[model samples]
Target chain A: MRAEETMNKLPANPERATLEGKNKFLGFWFFLGGETVLFASLFGVYLGLRKATNGGVTSQELFELPLVFIATMLLLTSSLTAVFATMSLKSQNFKAMIGWLVITVILGFSFLGLEIYEFNHYVHEYEHTIRSSAWGSAFYTLVGTHGAHVLFGVSWITLLIVRNFGRGLNLYNAPKFYVAALYWHFVDVVWVFIFTVVYLMGKVG
Target chain B: MGSHQNDSVSKHDQSHLDIHHKIAHQKELKQHIVSFAMMIFLTMLSFIAVASEAISTRFAILFILVLAGIQAAFQLYIWMHLSHKGHQYPTWGIFFGIGVAATCVAAGAAMIW
Candidate 1:
């Protein structure tokens, strides 16, 4: 009985307890590193063409702080919830982890909704769009790319939760949960730049 | 690799390990909450820096960018667990990406002129 108890015990970090888990964990970070470069290129293009409004609405005139602020808050809070999910994963509390992930997904959806509303408002009210001008194209591409990421994250977490609802926490699925949380956090990290360079910087000018 | 030895430990020792893990996780949780609060404060500060007319455009841009850097560090190191042990390779990967990203941003800025 004692031997079985020890055998059944989970490692402190069940996610990286095995070679496969370790590989998944490291590979995901490397993937995030690659993702950083991808977004950086987009950011570069946006910066170069940000001034070319081509008689369309300028960034300063088009951006509203309250909307952007709310979106940032939503995403930032979602990042925290994802962290909580990770903590729960570490402690092997499958239900709490799912609960936290659900909250994270909800926040992600809220952020995406705000982005859609913001884009629609810009198009209808100010005529700013991807086809409007260089600046318009740059703005939409950079911010829209981020919005798409939020959508992807929301979907990813939802699927993870649903698919794993019945499969309790174990080494097999623990790394998956950990990796998903990492991806969600990476999404938020990208937004930190977006809000700073795209929205906040645009407002400052 | 050595985790197999854990199977030989008595049940009482195993529970002790579990308790230790729980205590450590609790402490880590508190630190994460503190980091979260700091991030929120920084975000608000950046927004206010841009919203107010008191700060010049040049200064506000620089200030907010700095804040963004700090906030990103907090997320990466604390929330992402990059600060924990066994993250050496992950750190290298991320820094390399950031280095290349910096070059890309510089190139983009150079195109502006």
Candidate 2:
């Protein structure tokens, strides 16, 4: 009777029930706030130095709109997939949530792969190494940091799936999945800026 | 007698949960689909503005930046559900981050290269 009562009292969002989960939720937001500052600084630097190419290949010569546009679509769609997974979690469908999360991770990996190819092509084709010019250095460091976040997100979600496989949607596991989805969406937010401030502005300027 | 009462109580809880969840699912489904479609449209519009020469260079930059801002807002409020109830603190957290970020942009602009 007691166990059933506890189960019966489970809120729609089982994730936010416990104190620990609430703390995790709020603390993670603070961390993301700090990340916002970090990225902002990098962005400012990239803006300041993007034109100081020291006579190397210019950003205009290197950026292809079609490729960057496709990558942007991939990450944006992944954000929506993560949203679906969160909805599934709220609706108490663990299987469907996990399925959507798997799709999110795959899209993340694809974005990372495209980024790697983009950087390699620039370095080889235009001799745009970080050491080549001030512009090159700012460009790589700023965009590379965002790519690293994507790699980290993909790995984090993969580990969560592996560790929680066969585990039902209990309160403990619910918060874990919820925060991972949060982190994935945060990564998507950063990418929206990257494609805008970095790629789009680079093309325009 | 005790066991029979327990059985009835559990059944009642199940029925209540089913009704509640069904309504919520419908509302959330519409929210997600609408936001997703809007975000995609905004993205395509920005891309087109940049690709086409109908707009001047400076206007295009401002136009796309505004689009990006709106898209980010959609991702935060809709996809991340920050607009939902009981999200007061996290909302503060993100806005605080944005405040600091805006300051950084200002400082960086003033510093110049």
Candidate 3:
């Protein structure tokens, strides 16, 4: 049977669709919505505790714009690559989709690596640790949560690519790919906020 | 009976075509790129505002927060496609989420202050 025939045989309710596909798709988006709130709360707490640095290290003394700019570029470029991958998926160009996803995954990994390096530099050079003060705790919690999302996104996309390598795009997998792209975009969205509230505002303050 | 048969035949033909074969409009991709560029520019502008030393710290904080708000709006509407057609549910979900977030921020700030 053709792919459509296979999909047709699947159920209607998205949550109960065969291949356990649509269920994961709708469920994941809802999960991401919850995650947005989780990050939002963290951001609120961070903003409230922003001035609680206890004279450990102020924002201007700690943050370097160039490194952050590079990291921002990496993540923004990754978001574009993810869009390309989704486009390829829509066009049924599985090979091209996979290629774009590979690029996106690499960008995400490099972004995570840079974030780790950035954190280490802050801790070692600036003596900024999560335990340093309330600001340190809030800073790490907010930005670290975003970093964790990026790390999760990288791993999620990598797993999707590996699991669906031999299998081409079908309804069973299309929603999965679509939601993964959505999650990637969400990560980028959160970073945009982080860049503004944490880095830029921190610098100004 | 004959009309019914024709209807079934057409449905059969349509079902064979995969929706994924449709190419996304190039214009949409261009729009996304433009929006991404705008957000990057906004980010840089905030950085410049902070580094300039011309603005007072209080004003700088307020200005950067406004810029951040604008960038967040761009990311949501454009990158996340939250404002697009067929995304009504997600749009509502995110807005409701933002409302709660704003309240939390206000209350949290108040409590801490």
Candidate 4:
């Protein structure tokens, strides 16, 4: 009876209230740590081979500021929405949490759409296929890996929302949402570097 | 009988704590908005530094890199809650990864020339 009563009223940090939740939180961060290294190596490779364009096109010619800026804004806003969702989850406002997450999912989709369009434009208009040049190979591999992460995040969150629609918020599902949001934010963090090192620097040179 | 009475008292206290938690959450909401705004401003600054002809290429590169570092800090600390309590292990784990990553980048870049 006591446990049931306490369960109904969320603890201060519902995401870390249970042993399982705490484990998930710690484990996910470690996973993100590994992911950072993975991306860093790819970044290193891209930076090394960025100048080898093989006479097709260069970074300055192929990358556009406008499209990248729009995509960055979309992903950044989605990260904020995910934060809001986590906040609502803490306050035990089930509907508010879901509302924020739905908005996040929408923003994620918009960002992905923009990326797909950007890649399509690059391939068709610029002839910048991965096989075209060493620079192209490195660029696509690095950015494409990041894109794959975005796709994974979008799919993960959508499944979470669907699977738990009937169940509402509970301890079992709270950590799931919290960890997913963290993953989403990490993806945004990677993009922050991508835009800077890949896009802006490419433009400058 | 005594246990039942104590339970009631704790329940009363729990309700009091809930109010405080809500107030704290409201404050955190403001922090989130401020951080987001700051990130947007920094991004624009980086873009302008590159887009304008006034800034030299070498300087623009350095300036934008510094801005990116600042923005990444905001995302990690504020948005990702790395500054919050109970994140000590996370701090260690991520930093270690960053250390390895920096080495990898240095090695890869050095191979070019």
For this target, which candidate reaches the highest DockQ against the unseen true structure? 1
TM-score of chain B of 3: 0.76
TM-score of chain B of each: 0.92, 0.84, 0.76, 0.88
Model 2 spans > 4 angstroms off = A1-9, B1-10
DockQ each candidate and list the results.
Answer: 0.65, 0.44, 0.37, 0.54
lDDT, candidate 2, equals 0.85
Which pairs of residues collide in candidate 2?
none
What are the per-residue Cα lDDT tens digits for candidate 3 across A66-90?
A: 8888898899889988988876765
lDDT score for residue B14 of model 1: 66
lDDT of each: 0.89, 0.85, 0.77, 0.90
TM-score of 4: 0.95
**A-chain TM-score of every model:** 0.96, 0.95, 0.89, 0.97
Scored by lDDT, model 3 comes in at 0.77
TM-score of every prediction relative to native: 0.96, 0.94, 0.84, 0.95
lDDT of 2 at A96: 93
In model 2, how large is the Cα lDDT of residue A12? 61
TM-score of chain A of 2: 0.95
Candidate 3 chain A, which ten residues in sequence have the lowest lDDT sum? A7-16
Q: In candidate 3, how many Å is residue A112 off?
A: 1.1
Model 3 CA deviation exceeding 4 Å by range: A1-25, B1-24
Considering summed lDDT, which 10 consecutive residues are worst modelled in model 1 chain B? B1-10
lDDT per residue as tens, model 4, A19-109: 9999999999999999999999999998899899998899999999999999999999999999999889878898899899899999999
User: What tens-digit string does per-residue lDDT give for candidate 1 at A70-98?
Assistant: 99999999999999999998778899999
Model 2 in CAPRI terms: which quality? acceptable
Kindly give the number of clashing pairs for every candidate.
Answer: 0, 0, 0, 0
Candidate 4 — which residues are off by over 4 angstroms? A1-7, B1-12
